[model samples]
Target: MVKRNIISVLDMKDDMPQLVELAEKLKKERGNHGEPLRGKTLAMIFEKPSTRTKISFDVAMSELGGHPLYLSARDMQLDHGETVEDTARVMSRFVHGIMYRAFDYKMMDRLGDSATVPVISGLDNLEHPCQALADMLTIKEHLGSFKGKKLVYLGDGNNVCNSLLYACAIMGVDMIACCPAVRMPNAEIMLGAARIADQNGSKILASHEPLEACVDADILYTDTWVSMGDSTSEEVAVKIFKKYQINQELLDIAKPDCIVMHCLPCHRGQEITDDVIEGPHSVVFDEAENRLHAQKAILLTLLK
Candidate 1:
């Protein structure tokens, strides 16, 4: 079994298949009415603002009969001089699990190290494991399986790309990132995905040429050009990522059946065009909805 702390995609590596299967079942059955998390409490901390991440986990916990306490970083004592370890120890005594959407990955690690309860990464600068699981679930729902599928991510390689790369590699999906060399994902993450790919009979490729990476891809994915707290100025980010936008011309280069995806809060006409994002090929909404179910599975698996 994988560890209860989902700090990275690697945390859930061994249970990916089972977790996805549980997500599918929960989605189909509309979840457990018996309330597996009855009387449980989940502490949610948001150091970074969010729409999807905030709503999904709160609702997931509620539907499973758990009370979710939403904590804003500004309102917490942690911002007023308390350490992450101190906060973690305090929260663990009150909650069955903890979910954090943070800007600093190290703080999340510290929280996990100090907490006895399950710790889930709602989102961090380094990875978004829940989104990756939901993404894979969306792919499986649409295309049946990850085996032999090719996924080309077009834009700045950030947290989403990092986790997606690991998820695809683990599932035997050929994963490719199409972005400028300067904006590619962390080398360690790419190397780790490559190692997983080698074991899973999959391939992981990171390249600067969009066309080369998108050629015959079964899935075309992308995220915002300017991630939260990105050091790059907006003008420079736009200038560098403009060429990598997922437009009709780019989609045409992929397989006709290719599904376009974006982990939303999408900047329309930026990383992806409005037409392409709203077009028939887009499964972005499905991906968003699966965030709820996929997270329900995570909460159930960890807290039940």
Candidate 2:
């Protein structure tokens, strides 16, 4: 049998609808859910610090009757010059699947290529496919549908935003990346998403003006301006991104029922404001919770 790896959101484009549906089903089944991955094992490798990604995958594996082994890069032989491929190959022999959160996309790719077992990207510098799945699930749960919904993503177009573009395009949700030109999402990814959006009858767009992008938007999204491993100084990031903050002014221009989302570990006053993230429009927590259910679906699909 062939193994599957989720290295990018586009990799799951064809399966996204079914994945979202399954995640929603799993979410509803929470505590009563039976063991689908009984006796299986998942190896989780982290090259970066994580909160939601770490916890969600751990809990998801546990709840599904699987063992979750956490491996930090510092504790691994790779720190002493072992290749990622060697680590992946060795781990594949002991695990049913591998989940990697890496700082380098190239290393993530190499891991996926070498692992014989299924490989799931917890996150990398290039994309966060799991997060995108959860984001899609959250949107479906709230708005009940993706058609005609407009999501304006504010601030840096980092990994989260890159994945969201493909996820939104796949789900037929129009998305606009509102950020400074210097912080725009990968052009190659944007083009790929635009192609997918064209096929789905949705559009992927970009804007430097936050207010213009937020108008009539059904969802407002943002992430920290300075990500881990980013060399940009916080002061410099703030200077460039302060205007793109998701606050009351932007919310007021959006649809009255628009929901706000942040992938978390928020710098309260930076990319987003306290009043907004804590306000009635915020579905950030719900979004965070969906991470578990979404990943369970991924696990079941790849490992079962």
Candidate 3:
């Protein structure tokens, strides 16, 4: 069998909806589901620090009766000049799968190309497919369906936004990435997702006006303006992103039932406000919890 690698959201392709359904099933079964990966092991390599990505993948592996081995890049020979391809070749011999959270997308792609077994992207500079999966699950759970829903993302066009574009496009959900012109998502990714969205009967749009983008939106999403390893200073980012914050005013512009979301480590006063994230319409925690179930589904699909 040919090995599968989820280096990008498009890799899931037609399997995305099925994976979301599987995630829902796993969530409900929880501890009742028997071990399917009893003797398997997943090697998790981290080149960047993470809270949700680390804990969620670790817990997901344990819940499925699989072992997760955490490896910090700094502690490995990779830090001292070992190539990612060599590390991937070595790790594939010992583990059933490899999950990498990398600072560089190029390195992640190299690892995926070299690995013999399934390789998953915990995150990379360009994409966060796992988080996007969880976001899809959460949207499905809360909104009941993706049919005619519109999601407006108000923040920097970072990795999270990039993956969401692919996820929304695949699921037939209309998405508008609203950010400053200078902060727009990768042009190539936007164009690719637009093509996919067109085929799915939905549309992907870019807007510099947040208020206009939020009008009639069914979901409102945002992330920190300044991400890890970002070269932009907080003071400057905050100044530019002030109008894009997901506060009560912004939420009011969207549909009355619009659910607010923020991929965590959020800057309360910057990308999102305290009251909005803690408000009745907020599903941030639920979205966070879905990470475990979504990733479990991904693991089963690739490794089982």
Estimated TM-score for each candidate? 0.97, 0.99, 0.99
- Per-residue lDDT, model 2, residue 99, is 93
Worst 10 residues of 2 by lDDT: 78-87
Which lDDT tens digits does candidate 2 get at residues 207-244? Answer: 99997899999999999999999999999999999999
Of candidate 1, the 10-residue stretch with the lowest lDDT total is 26-35
User: On residues 140-259, what C-alpha lDDT tens digit does candidate 1 reach at each position?
Assistant: 999998889999998888999999989999999999988798888988999999999999999999889987888998999999999889889889989999889999998998999999
- The lowest-lDDT stretch of 10 consecutive residues in candidate 3 is 76-85
Report the lDDT of model 1 for residue 238.
Answer: 91
Q: Please report, in order, the local distance difference test score of every candidate based on alpha carbons.
A: 0.92, 0.94, 0.93
Candidate 3 deviant stretches above 4 angstroms:
none
The list of candidate 1 runs beyond 4 A from truth reads 1-3
Q: How displaced is residue 274 in candidate 1, in Å? A: 1.0
